[model samples]
Target: MPKARRKPEALDGQHFEVVVVGAGMAGLASALRLAMFGKSVLLLEKHYVVGGLNSFFARGGRKFDVGLHAVTNFPPKGSGKASPLIRLCRQLRIPFEELALSPQSFSRIAFPDVDLKFDNEFGFFISEVERLFPREQDRFQKLLRTMEAFDAYSPEVAGDVSARSILGEHLQEPLLIEILLCPTCYYGSAVENDIDFASFVMLFDAIFRQGLARPLDGIRRFLNPILKRYEELGGKRRMNLGVKHFVTKNDIVERIELDNGEIIFADHVISTCGVVETERMLSSASQDENADDVSRISILESIAVFKKQPADFGWEETIVFYNDADVFRYERPDELTDPRSGVICIPNNYRYPNGEQMAEGQLRVTCLANYEKWVALDENSYRSQKEICRKAMLEVALGYLPNGNSMAKELEERTELLDIFSPRTIKKFTGHLDGALYGSPRKSRNGSTRFGNLYLAGADQGYVGIVGAMLGGVAVANNRILRGD
Candidate 1:
């Protein structure tokens, strides 16, 4: 068993080499990396628990993960140093085997006309594309080569370049393009209707190329190890304490005021809260230019727990990205949610060791949601709308499953519990303005700000997914903080 996390010493009037805000993946990783380098780092979080959007919650004695559908960027064992997961483990000094990851059986992209199934193998996806859209097979290959060469992490790269425009240049079939965009955009894109080409390349590499996997026990299994390792390295952390403001002097953060009104100081501050949220903490007035960049895109998710496993009812795929409409619309709806296109995730489908399985079946349906519409509702209306939208989302999602229409009545009957989370839940918990799922459309690629010592990480740092967020945090710490940039 791991040692208990030691409580941090008093923070008021204390100084550190670096202060990391928000205990999300990025912030945790940043503080851990800095600590490993023998720097005095203070990690602060407003929430009592860590993990931020990737965190978990307990209800009725059962735990549920928040943002994890699957941990993207899963490479097979012995995949070598080039793998991002491998590199991250090496940097953080954690053993790869400690995560106890389980690979997916297979997942599918379901549309009104066609269904494409893919697993960890890139060739399988290629074969599916060839079998489904034979005319664009060669064009798709060319597109893959283009994505392979694109330097998505370069600070000088243009992040706002439209991915749809690039896809148009490479492929002629609009359906195929939309089909590919369905999963990628849902997984990471902040921009409505389309994802930027830079993010497209990164997410394409993460989801399709590197593949997806989950820890045997969900996110806490993954997070606890990192947190344990951070504590072992003598990293200091304070829960339920948040940065209220950044007192700046001539474009450099001189001090930080906590939500409790206590003050602390650091030479450099790294924020994983988000671009707009971070900017708002500044004492200066010039940081308001990027306010409009706050993302409008958010999601509403419905989690249903059933009496039996998903496979027992013939729902075997690990994840299903589905679209009821001919043209997939990846944007916030005028109403609360757009159930026409969404994702269905079955957590019970992973191949755990020794045939171990979850005691109960679980299904999660996610759909694009309008933040403003959901936030404007009163408590009574919000509760009523949740129930109404929960049924609607599940109803549409069930149609895409194999023999799903036939099993709907039985599945509904077998459902033991149901929980729903909206854009309002995201905003209230993660402190993301507008409850944006992927943060601002305009990214701070270099993690730079007008304040010289303040840098951004996580969503607004232009990386997506859990692995990407950790990489973003490590990069900023290495490039800017460690290298003295």
Candidate 2:
């Protein structure tokens, strides 16, 4: 049966105070906050569902976070302190939980016979690193200070600073170098890709702090309530309505035109679609200008999700990798240029619903494939190529795990590609420039994407995870609408 169209009980505003386009997490969160402030809000989604990039599915006997493996560094609520995302959730009645790992839950570096576990807070992280390599204690302290300082210093201040730029200038240890590159898989970033200090710090601080939380019942459980509350607050949403153009009146976006030929007029427009797509909707430009903006994106992370039994807790972690010593070479080879990464997880007790089980296990493998690679292909060609890419990824999987062939077959049969939002897909569905995850994260140019009255929230800004996206969502609300506006 087709999913029912869930229209709002009341959508009485002819000209809403806030008009949000793209009902992804960021758009939804922005709409919720705006509605709470007594603004009539209308949120439009191009897709069938609401979660955008922040969503999940049930496979095996467990639920899995589709793209977000785990989100860290979100400040938990309590007496005196809280992170901005947490505060917004509370104010908007969005349910969330702060999860603590076994201190050694992240970046447990293992090379051959030696292993160094990264656990605890900032201080503890330094202590653990120092304990492993006493000689680098003093150097480690400097790294911590750098991270602390970097956190306060936004990308707006940092210019063309790649991860290598900061690491090369300050710390230079082979062990530490490996540690720095451990999670590059998250963004599918290559060291040469100019991941400035600010971006590097965002990823570093998150993994070190909040550990990871497998949303209460995967992302669905976490977001459904928020969506429900959005309706209760009199916010409106529509799905499968691909926004095609933005109609500007009085120098502001007055309404959005959907591919379905429906026109929605509103007082404000919040675009969670992305940088490239947002511009396409508003830009009256030639191909040359569009091409230049395409290269500004730093990375492209393609995610694949499959239906299977969920991996349980205390097992091999959700983001697991069975890397074969023989296949991996520190030096980048032509074959492995688009680095393939691992994520083996089961929806165990800690992350599953009260009765959810990992009957059909779930797994997702993400890699950084070039947008140009896909965009260059014709539609039919691209469709055929996606399967080829999947097969190649499966081979890469075999290279990681022992029963590589069998596991690859199982996943190949069940797994489906999720990162269709490549540059072209972004152009097609979301209408982005390069299908950039987070609008141009170039610290060199737009810095923080501070356009006059225009803002960004989604994977394109801040960090890249559930927590980061939520925080970005709130930032759009706070910086664009809430803060004394």
What's the distance in Å from true for residue 186, model 2?
1.7
TM-score of each: 0.96, 0.75
Q: How close is candidate 2 to the true structure, as a TM-score?
A: 0.75
Candidate No. with top TM-score: 1
Global lDDT of each model? 0.87, 0.53
Q: Which portions of model 2 miss their true places by more than 4 Å?
A: 1-14, 56-65, 74-85, 95-116, 119-128, 131-134, 152-160, 184-192, 295-315, 321-357, 375-433, 443-453
Give a tens-digit lDDT track for model 1, residues 398-471: 99888888999988899888888999888866889889999899788889887888899999978888888888
Residue 278's lDDT in candidate 2 = 66
